[model samples]
Target chain A: MPSNIIGWARLIAGVLGLSAVAYIAVTGNYLLTALGFAAIYVVFVAALNLFMGHAGQVSFGQNAFAAIGGYGSAILTANHGWPPMLAMLASALLAALVALVVGQATLRLRGHYLAMGTLALGLISYEIAVQWEQVTGGYMGISGIPPLSIGGFAAETDRQVFLVLALAAVLACWSVWRLRRSRFGRAMGAVAGSEEAAAALGVDVARTKVITFVAAAVYASVAGSLMAHAVGYISPEVFGLHMVVVGFTMLYVGGIGTTLGPLVGAFVIGMLPEVIRGFRDVQDLVYGVVLILILIRAPGGLAGAWRR
Target chain B: MPEATLLLQFLVTGAGTGCVYGLVAIGFCVIYNASGIVNFAQGSFVMLGGVVTYSLWHALHLPLAVAALGAIIVSVALGVLTDLLVVRPLWHRRATMFVMILATLAVQIVVERLTLIVVGDAPMSLPPILSRGPIHLGPIVLDTQVAFIFAVSLLLVAGLRLFFTRTATGRAMRACSIDRDAAALLGIPVSRLVAVGFALSAAIGAIAGILVTPTQYTAYNLGVPFAISGFIAAILGGFGNPFGAFLGGLMLGITQSLATVAFGAGTRNVFSLAVLLIFLLLRPQGLLGTAKT
Candidate 1:
């Protein structure tokens, strides 16, 4: 396919995909409930890719942002009786704010130190989510969340929610595409390729990294909102280390910088368990083994392979 | 307990726990010094050493000495595989130092969980090869923890010293750590020796695990604490110096014990974390490594 055709095809597929999801809502396939999960993870991987793939900052705290988003959205809609739209927006903004705070302290560190700083941030968030009982509902999670509806159309089934979530994911990918072509995105690329070299060229290296961090956090938060809406509940487990691994896997496997890579990664990982429902015991081991193999052969990720 | 008694008890505990941390931290220092990458899976190696030893000796009915030997050998294999599968690939790809760390984390998680699946979720216990009775003085009591802590940590450190100082391969490993290109030019097989560094680090992890298991027992949950504690201890000591790691580990033990008395035993982790947090925020280059990318 022509490069331009590939771009157009991706756009058309996204729109049509949303319509199909809407059709799934009308038909109500319980198995398609898994797609809601895939959509959520797609957003998650895109967020991580923005930081690690594009901006060259490796953060283990996408799960933190997801937690912030999950709790922020769930509490607002579940307890405060806010509209879903407002709750989602608030959660995204909250994640961005958190990103800002963490960025200020950690952006100074580089290489291994930076990874540790972010990992620490992730651990601290885990502590807070686990320890803070009243607001977060502690380990048990906040359940009985009301499903979101567009105007009069209430999401009575997982299909409806999946459709909406998928659209959000598409928008996330669109944003990734916009970023890949933008000057800011190019600057992020420059930073990732070489920070000192970018600094020598007088790029605002620190600012660029912090901004990318905030953007990635926002993306993760938005995805978390959709995830909260889909399950009609939010829990601290959704933001744990295992979830972090899932995000990392999707982002890395999706090939990092490629706009479409996360979509591929999310589908493979999200759908794999459901696809091969058997061998539940060995699935994680298998996934891990496959991921390691992929890393060894395709360190740049699946997108890296495609690019090559 | 009287204040003096508590202090002495804590000192013993610190020495015991500190000894284990120091051993693990020494491994971290060796690997970091050799290969500029902080192997986050160092804890997994420790856990693996313990778990494998537990399985080999108790479950598979192997002799304790044979089990320990098997554990050490397997751990060395893991270290070699980690290098081949994760570290060498990232290095080969010319990945940023940060990316290699990320890869290690990825590998660590995989290894840690695989240990859990294989060993089962419950903590593993083995009968001590040596006696583990507590000997109480008038006010202060000492147990196997205190008695063996020094014997294990210091002996390993001393043994490592002799190996490095006396043997050609050991000195070659040290030289390779300093400058791989120059070491290779000087006719040392840099890649082979660096892999050896990984093997030795794994062996240290295994030995430390074996020594500590009689007191704390072996569990999958130990990996995170081990990795973080070892890293922080190594960082405290200055990332490359084994002696520094020994001091750093003891200091952590002291802080943890003191913090336990002051803030409550439950807050001991909070104490360890707080110290590392302070270090990260202020003096990150550490006692040995010095701050540089």
Candidate 2:
């Protein structure tokens, strides 16, 4: 198993996997819808890896940014009549702004404190989404969001939507891959190793953490917007704590620090429910058990193990 | 009711729920002290206490008192099992804090799903222990259940204080919290004590659930919300400080009740979460806990 051979194998497998989903989507099968969702989650998990795996931080609040992007895109496109693409970009910026403020306040904390702070941030966003009935429609949610489009070419069909989502997912992964090799990515890796040590080495640990946090938030926001456009509906539950749980499962199962881990984890986890739909009552139980087993047996995740 | 009376009523109700949060927070502190792991499954013990008691009393035709005791026992056993099956292995591996947290969360989800499968997800409740209507003290109306909560919580806190100060095992557990390696070197059964800590916390959480279930509903899904609130309470009281967690819980409960009155019930969680964010940012040491050096 030469390293280069492994790399080429992974690349080919990724292309083949995406092609399979695209084929299913073109043939009007429903599984591509799930793949579409997996694509959105890839963006989330990959961005999260930048912070958690690369920079050594914990945040239970990425869903907050997703909520912001979701509601932002929903309100902007559905109510304000902004174009969907423009709305998505605006929502991403808004998420980044919110993340900047939150990250500044919270990035000072380490370990469990950071986790708890982010968790609160997420719950606050959820509560607002549920309570702000006039704008968000409360639990009823917002629907009829315009699909993603560009200059008279709209992603109207499931295939087109999946294509758009797959592109975003690929771009998200590519950026993370590139960033991991860049100087900033090295800084993140250093910070993850030891913040005190990184600081001693002249890395601006605080600034690097804040920037990465904001970037992750932006990623989550875009995913949220894509979700809204793809599903044509947006609800508070779409970006709730469950999203955090699912994202974590994917990130860990695929390999937290690995480049292809998010994509692999997202697809495997996303498809798991459908695979075990018969055991609907025990779905969460299985997920929890599988997660624990993976953590104990293969903490590096599938992608990480493959690299080994 | 007059304005002051309405305020008093909210405070009384808030105190009742606060006591439950305090108990759950204490559970968190106990486990954290013993094992340096925050057991996210603490709330599941509370859920089990209520749900199991409901089944024993309603379906199995057991006496309510016996059922409550049985529920507490079951939760304690599950807590020990969680530590032994989940925490101990990871503890041996010296897993990172992130992995430890996620493991407990997974345990919590498993417990919740198991509860759902065995008992179903519909909300259940027990009859109030006192079975009397609300008690009137001046213009303030307090439910008999609330009074019961106060009595039990007081006794438990007193008992906990006595155990820690006077008992050898309790002191050993405290020793482990300060320094596990040192405690082990000093011949304390640190591993057993960790299980004991889990059992003690689980019992407290179960009691809280049993007491509160009479006032409201207990469903499988309520565990996460209670866990979040309890975690906030722990932070507010200062993490790993059981007494502080109790006070924090009371404060959080009162503030939430007041917020519900001021705004609507819908904004109650928002207010509490806001308090959490504020506290985490400004006063991470909490009210009673000293700042870590």
Candidate 3:
């Protein structure tokens, strides 16, 4: 049939996302606190899909960028007196810079070693965030974060920042979708599938990996910055390997090699705990179980269940 | 204490932790050798042994030795369950290597949390009678549990060497590690041997857990870091060889302890893993790698 099915799903999801925002705006149901969480997660996981799904980089450090994002935004706004809007962009840049350094150093590794090497970077970033006391506030975390706002009125009014985040998520998804169709995206994928083969065909393997990795980090960072603002708090624990695991799970459960996979995974997982309150205790457990089930049963993911 | 005594003391303490890592690393090697599957849940198995033993020993009032034995037995059983339930199904379907990684993670999360539900989230401990006695060696001081942990670990490693060298079953396991199909053709029950591989892996993991818990205590999330370190050790010593894994474990542990002293104590994990990464860059197979497929 037509690609209209995918379009309809996107439209319905957008409306639902907007309505969820409106519901929070009107009802002030702080349970939607998780909406901001979900929105930010969508941004991060979607960016992660660019590297992991499209480019074949099994990175576990997307959360490190998110950690950087939160801290970057927090520092810019909380300490440097930057506006919330400006702080967001700054966080993305900060994450990008760090990712650039890390990707360059570790991308030379092949196979599972590459995976391990990047995971090491993620762990170290997390440790630095925890141990570097005065800057990161150590383990207790940097708190009292200012919320995103339009003009004068604050965006901290419950679900308001989340509304903005959801809108941003839509834009990020659209941009990534467009990018996937771009020449650079194809080049990245080619490199991921076979670096030696791609190099033989004139692809600059190392540079492509570095750029793709940095771009992913930038996206994750911006999402993290928004999350810090939305939550009005940021913690070192938020940057741990668990976040990395969750990010990868979301991307893989949705579909690794597709444009929409991360978004769907992020949405489902993000909204899941909110759908049933008791599920909060075992939110991670459900995530793990469902993700494994999906990985096994539908290797191509939920969207992949439909054959062309 | 004298400098030599202090050095000896740290080594004693460090060796216990190192041996546990070695055992855990060996467990990782066994599975990796048998199926070419890197079992990231090796740490979870260690935690299970520690937590289960702690529960059975304290809550059920079993003898200490019996509790330790029970822990090994339970870990071995869980290893069987892991292979049969999670691994076998995945292996049967010939799931992608990536999916197998996630499946093992699923097993780890399920087992780890189920443990939290059974035992509380707090650090589970043994009786002070087992936990708080010490042994004096020259001018060096060693805790009773720590001393036993190191001694037993060395003994186990030596015993494993003999068993592998001397026994027919062990030789078959070795043969399978070389080539599964070839070993199967040589009248070896490859599948059963793989199960035994899991059993052996889990036993070592559990033994490490019992030794560690008296000192470090046990928690649901306890095994994760160990798994990461042990995996590093396995890589550092090559993926298939048990002795290389042991050396990797000791080197990693000593380096970690020294790294902590050099660059603040809390940042030890970062330094230790950094060392593993650096080592991997220099030698992809490992430091003392074995020649196996």
Candidate 4:
């Protein structure tokens, strides 16, 4: 069989498997709701991979962008009567613009400084979200968000929301795949490998860094919008600093810098709460242990393990 | 009613929190200097100090002084463990700075979750270590606890300054921070000092935690915000300079307090983030840190 045919076959099989999971989840409303949430995280983690895996910058502040996207769309749809989809798109673009500015400002920082700078940005964004109570509803959060709709069809139920999330996740994965195969993707790898060498080789290091940062921001924004709509509520607490750490955990567990890693990581970590439900108190403990163990034993992540 | 009293009140409270932040920031400086790895778990150690002391004193009915000591020991051990289990292994593996930083985050997660499990997630507090009631001096009114926190913070900073400059082990640690390879060549136990660095850092954080717990509520998650504030404070004063971190923390505290007046209470936290971002962009070396050659 041709290699492309094999790849297409695998993609079909994966989608079919996901559809089967969705079908089973539909019978159990709670499980479907959980999976719907997982799908949103899948998008966030995949977007993260574009930066960490491909571009090689660690953003401890992507959660801030997620909040931006979440709050941006939530406010518009909740207050202005704009369509949910349009609001999501606009918020994502806005997030990208913000990322562009932040990227230009801080991308020059090397290693530790860059990480700390992003962490500070995340803290600042969360503070802003909480303090801007007039818009974000403060700690109470904005509620009664309209369900995402298309051409008069609304996804009012968990099953429908799950379908939308899955579609979005698939699209995100597809786009990321295309991105990794592009010249820009190669440039990102070059930049990550050695910025000095990449510059020597004529790659625009700063521009590539900013573009990757903006792309990840846009991805997080969309994820946030979906989350706000799916839950019908959004708040600062939902996208706290923990999300940044958790998102990074997912990327690491699935295998950093791999196409399949994000989905795998998201699925594992997403379902993790349920898996350890019997030990309610140790849920986070389990996650912490898993994260450390993965980093130590298999820095390449689960997907990397599978390949091995 | 003197308006100056109100200003003094904010300044006093600001100084109290600022001093605690200074302590934590010094911890950041110590570890960052020694290992060149920012331990995100530094705050978790702070949380551990408070929660552990609270449990020892309140739950076990131990003496306050003894309970504080127990907390210090626990924090120091955990600090060493952080080095032995997390940092050293990763460092030996030749992990990237990104990976090492992530390792610290993992330690943070583990510490926080385990703390919640052990402490039952409730906000606990210690009985005031100082006398109750406010002391009025001219137009200023201050709590005894605030005075204790401030005085202790300054003493710790002075003690650390002497230790780093005057003591042999401390100088060894300082030498290691400056040039690990050279320090090792000079017969300094570089790895051991790194472990010592973690322990000392955690001890300072624990001290701050215990001192502040008399006036502040202790919770499992409080360490994160404290860690963040301390981090900004450290950066503001320069990453590895204890004195710089001390001054930075004080400035940050005062700014935050004043920001409450200017931007309302809700917006105060953003001040540190703003300060951090601006400093990082324009002068990453920080206020007291000399320009890197």
Highest-scoring model, DockQ: 2
Q: Write the per-residue lDDT of candidate 2 for residues A1-308, one digit (tens) a residue.
A: 33597787877877897787767877978788888899999999998898898888999899999998899999999999999889989999999999998888889888777777787788778888988899999999999898898889999888888888989999999999999999999999999999899999999999999999999999999989988989999888888767877888899999998888999999999888878875645766777888888887789998987786
The local lDDT score (0 to 100) that residue B135 gets in candidate 2 is 88
For candidate 4, give the docking quality class from DockQ: medium
Question: Candidate 2, residues B1-293: lDDT per residue as tens digits?
Answer: 59888898999999889999998999999998888888878889999989999999999999999999999999999998988898888888989999998888888888888998999979998899987788889888888999999999989988998888799988887898788999999899888999999999999999989999999999987787888889889999999889999999999999999999999898778788778879977888999998862
Minimal lDDT window, size 10, model 2 chain B:
B268-277
Please name the candidate that would achieve the greatest TM-score relative to the true structure: 2
TM-score of chain A of each: 0.88, 0.93, 0.88, 0.92
Which regions of candidate 2 deviate over 4 angstroms?
Answer: A1-28, A278-281
lDDT of 1 by residue, B1-293 (tens): 58788888888887788888888999987787667778878888888778888999878899988998898999999999898778887777787676677677777778877776777778887666566577787787878556766776878899999988799988887786677778889998766766888899999998888877877788875776677777778878876778888788888878887887787775676687778768777777666655554
Question: What DockQ does each prediction reach against the true complex?
Answer: 0.46, 0.65, 0.45, 0.61
Model 1 earns a TM-score of: 0.89
Model 4 C-alpha lDDT per residue in residues B1-293, reported as the tens digit of each score: 66777887898898788898889999998988787778888998888889999999988999999999999999999999999988888878888889988888778878887887777878999887865787887778788988888888988888998999999998888887788889889998888888989999999999989988988798987887888888888888987889999988998888898898777887677677777778987888998997652
Q: What lDDT score is found at residue A162 in candidate 1? A: 72
Interface RMSD of each: 2.6, 1.8, 2.2, 1.8
After superposition, which runs of candidate 1 have C-alpha atoms over 4 Å from their true positions?
A1-28, A79-83, A132-138, A149-153, A278-281, B61-66, B126-129, B264-270, B289-292
Q: Tell me the spans in candidate 4 whose CA falls farther than 4 Å from its real position.
A: A1-30, A278-281
- Writing each residue's lDDT as its tens digit, candidate 4 over A1-308 gives 32576566666757886776866665855777767877899999999999988998878899989998899888999999999989999999999999998888889887877887787788778878877778888889999889999879999877788889989988898899899899999999999899999999999999999999999999999999999999999888789866876787889998898898888788778887766675544765777777877777789987786555
Cα lDDT over the full model 3: 0.78
lDDT of 1 by residue, A1-308 (tens): 43686566666666785576566556777657777788889888888888887787888767889888888889999999988878989888888898998787778877666776677667667777877788889888998777876677777665567777778788888888898789998898899889889998888999999999999899888888888888888777678777777777776687777888898788668877777785533555556666666666776675666555
DockQ, ranked from best to worst: 2, 4, 1, 3
TM-score of chain A of 2: 0.93
